[model samples]
Target chain A: MQFHTLFSKAVPLLWYGSHVDKCEKLTRAPGGTRLCEASSIVVYKSSLLQILRLVACEVWDHLLHFVTLLTHRIIPCLDVKAGRVVKGVNFLGLRDAGDPVEIARQYDEAGADELVFLDITASHEKRDIVYDMVRKVAEQCFMPFTVGGGIRTIDDVTALVQAGAEKVSINTAAVVTPEIVRQTAQRFGRCATVVNIDPKRVPRDGFEERRAEREKQGLFAPHAVIPDGQPDDIVFEIHVHGGRTPTGIDAIAWAQYIVELGAGEIVLTSMDADGVKTGYDLVITGGVSSAIDVPVVASGGCGSPEHIRQVLTETDADAALAASIFHYGEYSIQETKQYLHEHGVPVRLTH
Target chain B: MIGIIDYGMGNLRSVQKAFESLGSQATILTTPDMIDAQVSHLVLPGVGAFGDGMTHLRDRGWIDPINDFYKSGKPMLGICLGMQLLMDSSEEDAPSRDQPIPGLGMVKGTVMLFAGDAYGPGKLKVPHMGWNSLNIQQDVSLFADAPENPHVYFVHGYYCSPADSNVIIATTDYGSPFCSSLKQDNLWATQFHPEKSQRVGLKMLENFAAC
Candidate 1:
């Protein structure tokens, strides 16, 4: 039995070592590599006697895996319309999911790393309703939450933060003012500031054939263009006011600019992938994630756990934000996390 | 009742709500006088720059009253910037001043920025945001009956480095092993927000209430 235990423990060490290259992005933070090195050495020395028996591998792998698992965050987004959690496809065709507070509580119990509430139809008079809803949601759950939609000024950010939001995501306001992002970050620290980027792939010459190729490649369906190796004469143009208006700005370049302007994190959502669930826009997601030093959350186009695994492993995104999959009771957060773990995409599973 | 010191920074409501959920009444103390005879425990909850934090605390006339409360031998808890405020000084906003801003000096340590000279850049994220596992180094009252290596929510650019390693009850690795929680006499402090950490965090707050 002891030999069997040792063998089981020793085997995963080799597996972990072979997969170390995949974990390079996990150590993006400064001095992170040194910490990994120092800890492994300490673990080695502490179990020196077990080295010949190959028994310390489990301990080393466990510690290192815990560190790397922090890289990927699974966020469940609640698109709120008049206080109810609503679901929409391609940023339109809204359907009721459930009560905002109730859904938030459910997500909390399901081990969602964070929760996002976007007031889809936010207006001046109805601001109080959103505040009350945010406070209620905050009261029920104990995880970090972000509130976005119609967040125009520092006052909006402050109100949400005061109402129990850890981070306030700015979308339309960020495009209109641009300085609000910097101001919010300066006041509440960069970590509390998040910028949501909604971009649609601009149609170019021969767009139909290219989109068909993408559909064949299995990224998306119904004429969704996924960028290939070549530039392919496509630009991801930014959209605002809940995807109703186009902003003529490039998504990748806008992401880079906002990060420089003190946006600590970016939530990149593909307008085309809003409810498709085929997968995240890997090409653009990867582009924005690599272009910026800050963390990027790949939002939209998450149908199955496989889609999540693909985005996390294939792209540089630090997290995956989904709405429809979790909203419709298709799969619980635990199942998704379990799937990711089995597929070698590290995620924190809390019981 | 637990007294949460609100010196014009941080989300004190969440801390208060966490305690309320745990069947404890947490009152937000705006003024030093608000830390009256009814308050049994003191919670210093804050976020933002260390220099700004100190300035606000001093401006609100919280220094002397807080020190007095500490001397009263009651359980005092600090969260995030509130934890940093307990230290001797901080490197945040140091360049603008001739000398580093002084903390409460209840503990001997200095607050250092993650991207500052110590950890340098590109190794770790500036603000060690999100959930991380806590490496419990000592069996303390704050973490009594706690699960092994419980993950907690953390959001801060600066971390507290206590002069005495003995005070460190837990250490969480973010680029390197930085102090995540510390305990000294009646004072218990954590760099992570127990309020936002979900079940494990709620349990910690329950433990703190019990203490």
Candidate 2:
């Protein structure tokens, strides 16, 4: 089957770090019966050293899968805050990297197939896109580039495209006015518009302890995170403004809706995996990729070439986008591609 | 000198830059007076829907001037939505549902939607997004040294199906073989965006510039 057809049935996987232990202990199987099947463990130890070990393990697993098929993309995302390339240190605070142009050049030379420049500060100001940054990056960058942040109207998209940006990504504005996607796609072309979905796993009802703990502590409890409110109900909720607001809509349903609304591609960024430098939340990537027919670009927690290999193998993503690892010069594009090739994954070689 | 007709569509800057990238001078002309004064190659680029775009051109009384410029027989090119407006009519109109809005009529075709097994049954995904290979149907100066089956960027849902298939110089597959480009004498139009399309797209623009 063609890749697009397979993508239609792709299932998104949401990573709940070790919540299985809590579920098994908290709720006794009815009459102490073996109610639930043996738990599937998906754990990510956030320690720097442990992450490195996990990276090695994941690479080995990916290498086995790569021998069978050739697909997957390594994408680098540049988060722009206040007109500078900024990455959230552990998804907490932002650090500036001076000019976007210089940083984009580095990524381009480093071998990023596609680049996403997200204006992280646009929603706060409620302004249109700053074309100057777009123009600067577009001037030097030679790869397919997607620019998000502060895209409010057709004019904003037109300005970005005119300034040399290939695709205009919309998130907040898309939520506020869903028709904006269709309108922009109608005017600019569907391929020119990309819908960026930042989703977070929310506690389902019936999972009361997890809800209570989350409410009181003002933090996510990893163990009780999967909402058990609805039986056999695994719901992924869509969040806007960098996972700051819950839209009360199912992430899978939203992904299908945006695609119907003429979105050329879907950029799925796992809020849980973002900036963690552990790995992509395979569960979410798989779930969303399976739901939408358009190409899915997996975003968030990509730390190594092994991480890139695992994402393409485990998830249905057409491409995997990372920031910190590539930006910090931990790996070069040629090195990653060569690694993928050696591992049996099909990747475009630089001529 | 390439004359870029600027009728409020948003792609003038990028198109001009593409021409400049190829070492060609492109002048964006918005007024009929300017187009009349400058008798050179003409490029009509647009970014919005067909009906509104035509309305703006008519509102500014550009139809007559544009027709006059076309009669001059200098090379003329239309990009993306501009290419769509070159048709005799389009099905994309809402307010003027039954009305047949006039296009440049340089090519004898009407804008229509993609049909058959490619798009499947349901809501059509307009604005066929992303990079797709262009199947060059004929030898034309517009392509110049560009590679065959070169991937060009596309962003529109509706495409121009010329009444005369012989005019279609290039075609691309997106659910179906839609006319990606058309050329008649000195008149040329591309459904794909050359400015946004990287090397190959620029090459096409450079061909236009050199022509």
Candidate 3:
């Protein structure tokens, strides 16, 4: 997720002092229902524009609508590998936390609105999910939780829901068989299926040699560079298995496809922004969000409260997902919410 | 005293911790002599391929000790793969591929791969991950405080279909209703991982400990 680093310095006056009319209008939908009542909306707008231009519009809209009708959400993600919580830079150098249940408890107590547990090894290991971990976490967690990683079958989704998870997130399996989405949504409710897409900017042929060198050194591949004379310069594509294989499919196209296939929500994680804490890739979030009507979760790079504020305010994302910064206690959920609230962002403050 | 029989296949530490959580001391015993000397209650935990699990048990001379433990009329709990080992034979391993390697024979069934269309052709992925509600078949001590449809964590593709359904203590459905938990006399087994299962799972351990 590529985030705008300039957002912190560009704090708007509307963020600090809320205009009563703007605040009320923000809380009320254009149709006059409560903001929360408009959780689902019909898509009436669709147009293709230059990538940079589209991103700029999204950022501007996100800022103008910062906290009006749409409320911000807090989601805690669990990266499960070998039945344990593992984290590394750009999906490499995995280190084990004590146990998934322990980590889940810590996040649950820290005021997380929802939790995501990704079975990072499910695909590579060709194994079933770690039910032991899911069962342990589900029994105690009160908030809605999503389980991802190794979900390959409808039975897997059934078992996850039965075990207590509220939703299931699919990536590799969904891409391999799109029907899985329709089948799962039909079996379980549509609201229970979340599709997570890991995407990276495909580098151009000229930069291939440089990209190969960077990849060899375990660095992120450079964004595809456009030839000096070419009109179309960069194309964003989906990356699978921790950004190792490039699908060459446009992120917006895939998002629309999955949503049509019955995905209730989409989680767009930027390979470049992931783990950097710099910010979310608003460019991608905006593009996908504009294409689909379902809730879009902006993931990957989320560093400071200001970054979150920027994404929630600027893009059409319904929620923002952060891992390292929140996991390490760099900032609290309350602080993040407070910061957003003080700014023009609408938030539900707990008494 | 509780003795966790180690055949070098499954996870025993979490089970040991679960027992300890219930305020009981459990020992992981690897040898038959150790089983003969100190074991008052026995727990056989196994993972990986079923045939490999049984081979390790037999190679370690745990076959007779486990059978003896059953004959001794002591409480014995079989978990996941260990539960499969309690059956007559398993199709998971090759040598015993078609041949039926003898099990504890306490339960009359064979461990077979789930064959059904609910998962679709090559579609229903194996290693049935996540949790499922255990449908109580017959009232058993292991489910003392467990709810009517208590969700238990499961992680295997193969399940034991006991010849006599009367012995099935609990059943769960993924594609079909299969044995989720089993109990007959002092012999008890569960296909789900209770140790890894949270509150209800711990409650199950407490029930087993009390038993």
Candidate 4:
């Protein structure tokens, strides 16, 4: 169910474009085997695209770097409140970070593949974000950046994209008017919109019993991981309005639905792991990622460079979003990327 | 002055800004008349659908001027969709079950989507958004002073498959090594955005502008 109240700005994401044909020739070739199915990497192992192995060291580095960049993104997320970057624990206990424009400049200089700006209080406060801020930030960064929070209508998405946002996110509004996704996709192109799904973990007791029961029932069951002393494996529930409320929607199901609706990507945030920084909710992220044909950006609870490395390596997520870790200078985006590159995750390094 | 055709599509500002950043004056040309004595080079920047872009090029009456500029023996560049428009036709409309849209036919090729949905499990997303290496196929001024296999920014769902592979100056892998940049005489086009690509992109734009 959609939350009736908004305590803070909840992130909504939209992805549209029949490629919006960004470049006349850099076409995102439209045809393809509809949503790849259990394909083999073996197909590419001997292909030219995977020819990094035979090249000389330096060329190999450059080629693999390109591969890493094409497949992964280390996105610096700015959780903006009152037009300033802020960090909150569990979407509460907010701490002032810095001015958005300047911090954005820092991320750009530090080699962020993409930038995400969430007006953390826009939805909770029920106010439209200032397009001027979006415009200012867009001008400051050459890389494509996405903005989320409190966006409810086509005009909201249009205003943000027009103000230089390559992508506009929809969270709470998606629950209220899911069709907004279709309308925005039709108008903006399927690649321009993204659906932000913040799912909270809910208890599913007798997990072993349920896993066995589901297997008997033939539900195409999820992988069961029952930790010691836990009541059963947990299933994630979609949340809206700043993680203040939970919906009946299943996280993986929602991800699949959004992609079918033409949303280009899913920004899957884990409420259970929001600000503790233990790490991302890998189970849900990987599950949702595998369930959808589009890219899934794993958000929430990144405490260190290793955390970014963990989410990316351990999950199928195409990108990872972190706020406080980068904002407070715990790790520069370059450091995070370098760590990833060193650990063999293949991130583009900025000199 | 470098004249950027303002056929009313795509990210035009950044291209102009990129040229400005390189200490060159790039102007957005909306009318064919603006293709004047002051402007030595032309750029066609594009975004949005091919049909709509062609309509804008037609409604704005830029088809003749752009083609004429190509004939003037002066250098011209088409970025992204502007580059694809130089091809003969595109399959971007195929998803709607519509016939392939016709293009300017400047380059011999048919623009089509990657095989399959170009989306889903175990496949690259159609937009193929992000940075990738450009495999330089030939030594052209566009890549002069640029590094070999330079990584450039790309964001597209369809790609131009040139009938004449020789015109393809460079190739970038995304399902396969589709044409990433192509040059024929003074006419240049890139699927990747040189403006957003930082150094390499700026260098290519600068090289084109220098002519």
Candidate 5:
């Protein structure tokens, strides 16, 4: 019999953390309690079996509350140049969006789970301006927001936190000095430290050709192989300095490394899909999300609420960050969350 | 005036700013001398390891003053790690599995890390970072004017299990119904950050300020 026949007759008992794909893999089960040999899924629809499933799911629900109760966070990012919110396509061509504080207040009222402010034009003299902007946002906005960009030292992290940023994200600085992440975590705790990873997909063939030429020139060893089975015949390479410079580091491996160094959260953005607003790069997002223990915020290329739902449901990402959709007033935070909640993704809906 | 204790763990400004937003003058008590008679309400705000918190309090000579303030019968509140510090001991930073580190003993309880294998194969992540609903158990002024089952922001790995159940005002289920907040006489504590919890949290702060 087809699996759809079983589905039509009986409901698959989905407890907490049970994926739909995992449920669809079920082939057969002799009884409700017994697991099928092929897919190891137990399916049952009898009244007594349904009661048992309910009781079991309830028991597991309480047991798994620590993991299951964490609602997916919807973070609206503000890429600020000096003090005003700015938008850029693929990290260039800056256009003024709005006042950072006003946009932050709107998101706060709209019940956004969190907010992110990145100083796109991170400069030395602009540090004071960022600090002032952070302080203003902190005073007006009640929710947690992370400030990133040009966070080069521990003092910068301290300044931002003191200015009311619950967490400080390190992007280029984290890539330059990995010790900064460890130091920040050690000093202020892991929850206060966030590492942002902007990864762009590179053609595997061209990358391999460059590597071979460099290796023949004795610049480096040839053993730095791209891991097997990368999706779409491409490997994600880490980019720094507002996605202007590319580092030869593997994005997934770098994520694991940063996690090891005690980054509380990882904001993974796909430069290839950013600003286009089609959808998130689920392949790399899922890749890094699965490879690490810390919460990964899948960012970039979120055009619609369905995209948000897809990334949250498909990938194990704990949060989704979008700028264009929210900044442009295409959708309110409440509407997006309503869409997510309706689509079976658990989100905190503020009335 | 509200005094927020700063032992150099986490951001105390947000808490102060939260109180300030509610038309209350709040101060970050950096030194032990700052915790004095003029301070009406005391807030012990912390985020980090239990041992580190205890060490900071002891090293900074805040242990005695904080205890004295608690004994003063004035309203006191604790947030996140501050809630854990009210306990007698904690499993975190313990010398051994059996020998837990000593807390302030202001409240009778023990803090334990969420065990990884409590729920079979898929273990839960630590630092339970996000907003979760509070299953308010007992009536308290802190939750006065707040909505039923209001969600609050929490970001911690360990949970407080007070030996005295009477002190537990609200119990949240984030895997087995751990103590989320407690109110005993003049002292109140919560495992969540009221400062970052949006409106519901601000209301709780307002109620505490009123107290």
Candidate 6:
């Protein structure tokens, strides 16, 4: 947390106004880290006032280095696509954000609890995970990092783990082959294994009940009805392939099964509220968190610090994952943490 | 040079890099014979099941040498599973058909897993992953420059309960206050990962290097 010491003596430009002799007044700022004061020589020119304003900005910039704070955590997710970070609206219309390694470094410096690198890049060829990208980030940063997106076999897990990934997330493979989660937990230990569940909220109000009656009358098909016939509070349904394909599996049930199989953590993303920047799906997040004993990271929609605070405080989820707010630089990890700290939520202050 | 013992575990490289970040020379000593005259301080860095870790140590002939290194009276530090391996025995391997896996017995303690039932329903998460503040039970030089109530990163299931309370250097509360760090003579171990704990962690490591 080094602040660049400035020793500037700029020559004043004199043209028309009368001025007295140069008078410099030195004053100390808060925390006594540095002397940030102004020399008022009673210059009449407005442009000279501009120099004073610039100096004030510089002083304020150094103020960020003075404060040391701590508490919970604010994690920013970097969905990597083709070596570049990207964000999509509801897992579609992918747009480029920044470089993965560069964004990772920024988050590390900003004091994120953990960084999750989702290798969203897909290709025709069966290539290994972005190992080189993970390796570079691991070498440069010293925070807990989790790598996910298309980790299938034990060899894939081994490669990523050896490349400095603290945890490997399983999503589609956990559904296609449930035993892989147990196998990975057996090899890398449960703490290093995670399951990312992307679920879409099912519409309530007996819609499925009506659809089931229609299907029974041969109006559509046997599998056309929703799983529970639209129960009043049927939470959410699991969706795979970037939340496009719906599996009749209940999101809460799947979370419990995955935990039973040895997933130490669960990352639940709400497809309904994702990319909308409203807030996390607290109902599902809290439901799944309370249902399982492991730490649940709430993912999907987090627009502001208040949104994060709400999920963390209102729900029993251990952590909250934000993408849009952090990606567009609306608020930094430090600012979000400050909001949480002021709101009486315990979070790590000094990075 | 700090010898980071690599008994076929994860994050061993991370520990080495952390030491290097502080301008300290740390080398990953793989074999038992490698930890000889050149090694200044010995560090055991590990992550995984206790039974599997001890098995790797025993099969690779690291058990006797690690004991010999501890006997050498040189400063030694163990992190996570490395800390658990310092106990006399561990219940983590009790379910196995073979006899219970024994530890190095450097400290009179047994490693036990945190039972999910004891903490009541949904009270505590297993693995206790993430940062936890250290309630320093006994003050030492390790946290000299670190902030008060230093929060270090941890990710593990089992914790060591030493028979002798005097050896406990610090404790962290997940559902209950458990021994998070302890020091006995030349041996010091922590259940947390100082390498990943950011600034305060870096300071603690720097203090260990100075010690």
DockQ for every model comes to 0.35, 0.14, 0.02, 0.15, 0.47, 0.24
* CA lDDT of each prediction against the hidden true structure: 0.77, 0.68, 0.68, 0.71, 0.79, 0.75
Candidate 5 regions with alpha-carbon error over 4 angstroms:
A1-67, A88-97, A205-233, B120-123
For residues A1-351, write the lDDT of model 2, one tens digit per residue: 235323322211123222333343344333433323445522222233444454554444333332212235567777787776665312212233566777665655555666788887745453343577777666555456788877777777777777767688998788778788998877766667799998777655533444454457654323222223333354466787668876555566678788888887889988889889899888778777766666788888888888887777565576788887766668877788788766545564432
Can you tell me the DockQ of model 2? 0.14
User: Model 4: per-residue lDDT, tens digit, B104-196?
Assistant: 998988898865243223345556666677778898888999875676777777889999988999988765578989988789999987777
- Whichever of 1 and 2 has more lDDT, that candidate is 1
**Top model by lDDT, which number?**
5
The residue pairs found clashing in candidate 1 are A29-B123, A29-B124, A30-B122, A30-B123, A30-B124, A31-B123
Candidate number of the best DockQ: 5
Candidate achieving the largest TM-score: 5
Q: Which stretches of candidate 2 lie over 4 Å from their true place?
A: A1-75, A88-97, A103-114, A122-129, A137-144, A150-167, A176-193, A206-231, A257-265, A276-296, A303-320, A329-351, B36-39, B94-102, B115-126
lDDT of 3 at A107: 57
Q: What's the lDDT for candidate 1?
A: 0.77
Q: Once superposed on the true structure, which residue ranges of model 4 sit more than 4 Å away at CA? A: A1-71, A88-97, A121-129, A204-233, B95-98, B116-121
Sorted by DockQ, highest first, which candidate order results?
5, 1, 6, 4, 2, 3
Expressed as tens digits, the lDDT of each residue in B70-177 for candidate 6 is 889888999888999999988885865255568878899888887766644664677688777787877798878667677788888889999999999998766667
Q: What is the DockQ of candidate 5?
A: 0.47
Residues A18-51 of candidate 5 have per-residue lDDT tens digits of: 3434343332323455433345444544333544
- Angstrom error of the Cα, residue B9, model 3: value is 1.1
**How would the docking of model 2 be graded?**
incorrect
